[model samples]
Target: MKWTDINNIAIALMDLYPDINPQYVRFTDLYQWVIKLNEFDDEPKRSSEKILEAIQLAWIKDAD
Candidate 1:
C-alpha cells in the first residue's frame, strides 16, 4: 500500500489499533504507524499533512 491507498491504510490501521480512536490520533503517531505498516510501500518522505489527514478521516469512517 502506498500513500495514495488511503482506504487500505485506514483498514490496516483499524485492524492494528482497534482500541484507539482515529480522531484522537496525533499526526506524528499516525505518520509512524503508516510508515511501519507491513504492506505499506512508498517513499516515507512522500507523505504530507494532507495525506495523513485523509488517512485519519478514512480510519474514523471505518471505525464507526
Candidate 2:
C-alpha cells in the first residue's frame, strides 16, 4: 500500500497493534510500523508529517 491508502493501513495497524491507542502513537513509531507492514511497499522519504497524521487519525477511527 502507498502513503495515501490510509484506510487499508489503518486496518493493518489495528490488526498489528490491537492493544495500542492510535491517538497516543508517536509519529516515529508509526512510521517504523508502517514501513514494516508486509503489504506496504513505498519510499520512506515519501512519507510526511501530514500523511502520518492522516494515517494516525484513520487508525483511531478504525479502532472505534
Candidate 3:
C-alpha cells in the first residue's frame, strides 16, 4: 500500500496495533511503522506530513 492508500493503511495499523491509540502516535513512529509494513510498497520519500495526518485521522476513526 502506498501513502495514498490511507484507509487500507489505517486498517492495517489498527490490526497491528490494536492496543495503541492512534491519536497519541508520533508522526516519526507512524512513518517508520508504515514503511515497515509488509504490504506497504512505495517510495518512502513520497510521504508528507499531510499524508501522515490523513492516515492518523483514518486510524482514529477506525479505532472508534
Q: TM per model?
A: 0.98, 0.97, 0.99
lDDT at position 60, candidate 3: 100
lDDT by residue for model 3 (1-64), tens: 9999999999999999999999999999999999999999999999999999999999999999
Stretches of model 2 off by over 4 angstroms after superposition: none
lDDT of 1 by residue, 1-64 (tens): 9999999999999999999999999999999999999999999999999999999999999999
Clash pairs, model 2 backbone: none
RMSD to the true structure for each prediction, in A, is 0.3, 0.5, 0.3
Once fitted onto the true fold, the runs of candidate 1 whose alpha carbons sit more than 4 angstroms away are: none
The local distance difference test score of each candidate is 0.98, 0.95, 0.98
Supply every candidate's count of residue pairs whose N, Cα or C atoms clash at under 3 angstroms: 0, 0, 0
